[model samples]
Target: MYKSLILLLLNTIFINVLWSNDYILNINDDMTAIKVTICSKRPLQLTSSLDNATHYLSKTSSHVEILNGHQLRLTKPDSCHWLIIPTNTESTAMTGQLLKVPTGLLLWRNEQIENDVINVQSPKAANAKLVNHSLPLPKINHDQYKWPKEPSFMSLFAYFGDFSQKTLRISEQSGSNLSLQINWLSKTLDSQYDSLISWINQVARSFVATSVLSGEQTVQLNLFASHSSESVPFAMVYRGEGTSIDAQINPQASLSQLKTDWTLYHEFAHLALPFIDRNDAWLSEGLASYLQYPLMQKASVLDEREAIEELWHGIRRGQTNYQELSKPNLTLAQLSSNMMEFRSFKQVYWRGAIFWFQVDLKLRANGDSLVRLLNRFNRCCRDLNSIWQGESLSAVLDQQIDYPFIQQLVTQYNNSTQFPQTDRLFNSIGISIANDNQIKVLDRPKLNRFFANFKAH
Candidate 1:
C-alpha cells in the first residue's frame, strides 16, 4: 500500500562503485534477451550486482547465476559471457541485473564495463562499434585488487567504474561535443530521452548549476521503469562517489504522464546533503523533499504558488499519517524508539521535510533563512568527496546560523514519532485549500518574501 510513497526513498541507495570490467553488449531484436560479454581482469571471486542484474541471468550453473542471493558468481572462465533477460521485478533492496535506460536505450554502470574499451551491438543499430567514452582510468591506488581466493585466472579488476559516460546516446557531434558530459544515453536524436535531456539541462543550469549547492559537478543518470505509478520518480546522484545513484521512471512515459511532483528536482535534492545511515534516512531524504519545492519553482518547473501549496499538502499528509499510525506520547527525537521498523516515507520524507521547513519558517521570522544557513555549509564542505551525516549537518547549520535552530528542531522533533504541527505555519504563509482538490495562495503580508529562496533564478 505504501509502495508508491517510497519511490524517492530508493533513489539515494548508492553503494560502492564497481571497479573495472570490459563489456560487449548485444541486444536481441525482441528486447527480451541481452548477451553481455565481460572481459574482466585476472583472478575473479565475485562480480556483484549493485541492484539485481544476476536475477535475469540463466541460472543453469552451466552459465552465470545468482550467488549468495544478491551477487553473481561466475561458473568458469575468468573472462565470461552472460545472457541477460528483461524482467519486471522492482525493489531497491534487490534490483541490479537489468540496465533500464530509455526504451531502445541501455544504461550500464561504469564498473560493469571494461576500463579501456566497450562495444555496443544492438540489432536495431547500424553496426557493432566501439563506444568512445569519457571516464579516465581511475588511478591504481591499491594493490589488493587481485583475483580473490578461488579459481585463479586473472591479475587485477580494472576500475572501470559504474554509471559511466560511455552510455551517452548522442549519435553525432563527433569532434568537440564528445567531451561535454551534459547529454543523454540514447544514440537517436528523436528519442524522448533527448527532449528530457534538454529539460534537465535547463533545470540544472537555472537552479543548481550556479547555486552554492552544485558547483562543477557532473551527474550520470541510469534510468529505469518506475516501480509503480505511485512511486516517486527519483535519481540517485553520484557526483563524486562511485556506485552512483539509480533512478526509476517509465522509460516510454511522456513528460506529461510524470507525477505532479517534480521527480527530477526531488532526486537532485539528495545532492544537497551528504549520505546518512538508513537509520537517519530522514535527514538526506528530507533535504531532498524540502528543497525540491523551492528549486522546482526556481527552475520554473513549478509555479511559486504551486510549490508552496504542494508543500502544505505534503505537510497534511505527514501529520495525518502520524496521527493515525504513531505510538502514543512519542518524543520527536532523532532516535525515536517509536520509529517504524520498515520506515515509512510518510514519516521519514514528508514529516522529515516538514521538520526542516518548520525550522526555516521560524528562522525567517527572525530575519534568517535556511537558504543562507545551507549556503554557509556548502561554502566549506561542498566538496563531493566529503560525506556529511545528518547529525553533523545540524551541527554545521547551527554554526552558520549562530543559533541552535536545526539542532533544536532535530533534537526536539526527531526524538519522537509525533509530527511537528504545521497548521499555524501554513496559515501564516497564506495557502487556502478549496473543496474540489484545489488550492489558492492568499495575499498575506508575511507571504511577501516567504519564497525569496526560490528567486535565485
Candidate 2:
C-alpha cells in the first residue's frame, strides 16, 4: 500500500497528455498498480465492469459500483476529477492466474477507459488523446529481461483495442524489462525464439511439401517475461493472411520448455487454416494441435513414435482437464454450442484433434490422406478475411475429395462426450510401451507400413 496520493477534491487541475485525452497513468513506486487520473472540465458517466466478480478497478468505491445500469455516474458539478487504480503488476502470462508479478510494466491504458469506443475511427473519444508510441519499441537494456522491438497490435489489443493502431505508450519503467510484451515488432527470435520459429518453418515446409499451402510467409514474433518457468503461461496466435501473423513467447522460458512446448507448432498450424469463430475453437485449435505432431515429425523434432506419444499425452491432458457438464454425455452439437455451460475448451481441443486423427487414419485406409484434403481446403478458401464455420467448411472440404472426413467427424462427435481414444490408432501404427516404459515400434510388417505411410518420410 503506497500512500502517496491525497484525496484532494478541491481546486484540482487535471493535467492532460497524449492524444488530447486528459487521462494520465502514473506508476506506483513499488510497481504494483497504476494510478489513473483524468481531470475533466465536464461531467461524464463512467461505466466499468460492475457486474464482474473482478471489479477490474481496484482503488475506488465512492464513484463506482453496480447500480441500475452498472455505470459509475460521475457528476462533475464544477471540476470533474476522477482517479482510479488498476492493478497491472499482478497478472502475467506465466501463472494463468492474476497474481503479483511486479515486473513494473503497465498495459498502456487507464484501466477503466473503454477502448472499443475509443480506438475506433467513427467513435473516437471526444477529448481523448491519441499519443500512440513509436514503432519498433525501443530496446531496454535491463539485466532482468529484453524486448527486441517496439510494441504493436497485440499490446494495444490488451491495453487499448484489437484493431491495429499506430501509437501506444509504456508510461513507466521505460528502461526496465520487468514485464512481458507481445506486439508486431516487440521481441526478436534468438535462442528460444529461433528454435520455435525453426520448428515452425520445418513443419511449414512439410505442409508445403504436401502441396497444401505456400512457404513464403511473414510471422511477427513477440516475447515477454514469464511468471512461471514450468510452461508458457499465456500465448496467442492471431491475424490472417495479408495481416501480420503474430505469435507470443516468454523470454524467461527455458530452452527445454520452449523447445518441448507444442504451443509454437500449435499456433503455427493455425496459420494453415483460415480464421474461424471462438465458439468453433475445436476446429481451429484442434486442427492446429493435431497437425503439430506430424509437422514435428517432418522437422525431425519428434519421431513417429514420439509423435504418437505426444498425441497420447495430449489426449490424457484433455481428458484430465475436461470440465464436467450437467449432461454427463456431450454431443458435438451441445459441445459446440456457444452456451458456455456445455463447452469444455480442453475437451474440444483434444477431442477435435482425435476426430482429425481418426478421420485421417480412415481416409488413408481408403487410399487418401489428410494433407490432400487440407490442401484442397486451403486452395478453396485462401483468403483469411473469408470467415468459415463448421457447416460451410465441412461442405467445402467434402467437395475437395471423395471422402468427407470433416463432415463425418462433425456428425459423430457433435452430440456427446466422445473424445478420441488414440490407443487403437497407436497400436495400429505399431506404437507400444517397452519393458523400460519407453515408446517403441512393434515388429509388425503391416504396422511398419502403416507408420511409414502415416507421415511423409
Each model's lDDT: 0.49, 0.49
Backbone clash pairs in model 2 (N, Cα, C under 3 Å; residues 3+ apart or in different chains), count = 23
Predicted candidate 1 versus true structure: per-residue lDDT over 1-457, tens digit per residue: 4775475445333211222354555655433444555544443344442334355454233545455533455555444545454433342111222234221111232232235344555454443222222221121121111111122111111111122242222211211111123323333212555545555554444345324352323334544455455433556654322223355655556554443346766766665555555566677767777877777666666667777877777766766666676555544444233356534456667777877778777777777666655555665664432445557767777877655767766766566656666656776677666655466667655454676643212
What shift in Å separates residue 74 of candidate 2 from its native position after superposition? Answer: 36
Q: By summed lDDT, which 10 consecutive residues of candidate 1 come out lowest?
A: 152-161
Per-model TM-score versus the true fold: 0.58, 0.53
Residue-level lDDT tens digits of model 2 in 285-336: 7788788776666556776667777877787777765644434565655666
